[model samples]
Target: MSALILVVDDEPDVAELFRQQFRKELRASRFDMEFAQSAPEALERVGAAEAARLILILSDVNMPGMSGIELLPRARKARPDVPVIMITAYRDSETRPKAIEAGAAGLFTKPIDFPELRGEIGRRLDAATGPQ
Candidate 1:
C-alpha cells in the first residue's frame, strides 16, 4: 500500500507544486498526497484519517492561526509515530531553535529542494511501510 503524506501549509499553491513534483509516483499509487491549509485543519485531517497509514507530515511554519511551531506538539500528541517536518521560508536562529525544541523531525527552508524532499519522503515512507 502507498503511504499517506499530509502537507500542512497556508499557501494553496504548494499542494499543486507537490502534486506536480510527485506526479509520477502519485499516478502509480506509490504515495498518496493530502493537504491541509491550517494547523487546525491538519489536526482534523490527521484525526479523521486515523485508519490511514501516514508516513510523514510537511508543515509550513507561518500561518494566520496556529503556526507549525505551535502545532508540532499537538500534532505529536495526535500522531506520535509520524514524523513532522517544518517547511518554511523563514530560517532564522529564533525559529530554528524553537522548531527543534518543539520536536520537528526536520526543518526545510523554502524554496525547497524537491529532489531532496522526495528522497527523504521516500526513505521515511519505506521505513514506515516497507518497500512499495
Candidate 2:
C-alpha cells in the first residue's frame, strides 16, 4: 500500500508547500498526501481514519494552542508506529530534547529544504513500513 503523510501546520501556505512537494514525488510512486491545520485537527483526522493508515506526520512546532512537543506524546499514543517529525523556526537544546522526550522521530528548522526533508521522510517511512 502507498504511504500516507499528514502535513500539519497552522499556516495555509506552509501546508500547501508541503503538499506540493510530496504530491510531486508521489505522482511517480505509490503514495498519498493529506493535511491538517492544527494538532487537534491532526488528531481528529487520525481518529476518523479508524486505523493506523497514517505513516508520517510532519508538524510545525509552534502553534497557537499546542506546540508540536505537546502534541507528540498524544500523537504517539494514538498511532504508536507512525513517526512524527517536528518542524520549527526556533532550534535549541531545550526544544530538541523536549521533542525527543515526547517521542518525536526527528526535528527540523523552518524554511525547510523540501528536497532533503522528502528524502528523510522516505527513509523514515521505509524504516517504519519496510521497502515501499
Candidate 3:
C-alpha cells in the first residue's frame, strides 16, 4: 500500500506545488498525498478510517485558525505513530523550539528544499517499514 501523507496549508497552491515536487514518487506509487486547507479539516482526515494508511503529516506553521504547532498534539493524540513535520516561512529559533515542544517530528523552512525533504521522508518511511 502507498504510504499516505496529509498536507495542511491554507494556501490552495501548496497542494499543486507538492504534487509537482513529488510527481515521480506519486507516479511510482510510493506516496499518496492528501491536502487539507485548514487544521480542522486535517483533524477530520486524521480521525477518519482511511487514517490507517497515514504515515506522515506535513503542515504549514501559519494558518487562518489553528497553527501547525497547535495542531501537533491533537494530531498526535489521534495517531501517535504518525510523524508531523512543520513547514514555515519563519525559521526563527522560537518557532523551531515551540514546534519541537509541541510534538513535531521535524521542521522545514518555507521555500522548501524538496531534495532534503525527500531524503527525510525516505528515512522516516524506511524506519517505519523496517527492513522491507
lDDT of each: 0.89, 0.81, 0.90
Against the correct fold, how does model 3 do in TM-score?
A: 0.94
Q: List residue ranges in candidate 1 displaced over 4 A.
A: none
Candidate ranking (TM-score, best to worst)? 1, 3, 2
TM-score of each: 0.95, 0.88, 0.94
Candidate 3 C-alpha lDDT tens digits along 1-132:
777899999999999999999999899988799999999999999998365578899999999889888899999999998999999999578999998999999999989999999998898778766533
Show model 2 residue runs off by greater than 4 Å.
Answer: 50-52
Q: Cα deviation in Å at residue 46, candidate 3? A: 0.7
TM-score, candidate 2, is 0.88
lDDT of 1 by residue, 1-132 (tens): 568999999999999999999999899999899999999999999888755578799999999889899899999999889889998897687887788889999989999999999889889977987776
Model 1 residue 114 CA deviation (Å) reads 0.6
lDDT of 3: 0.90
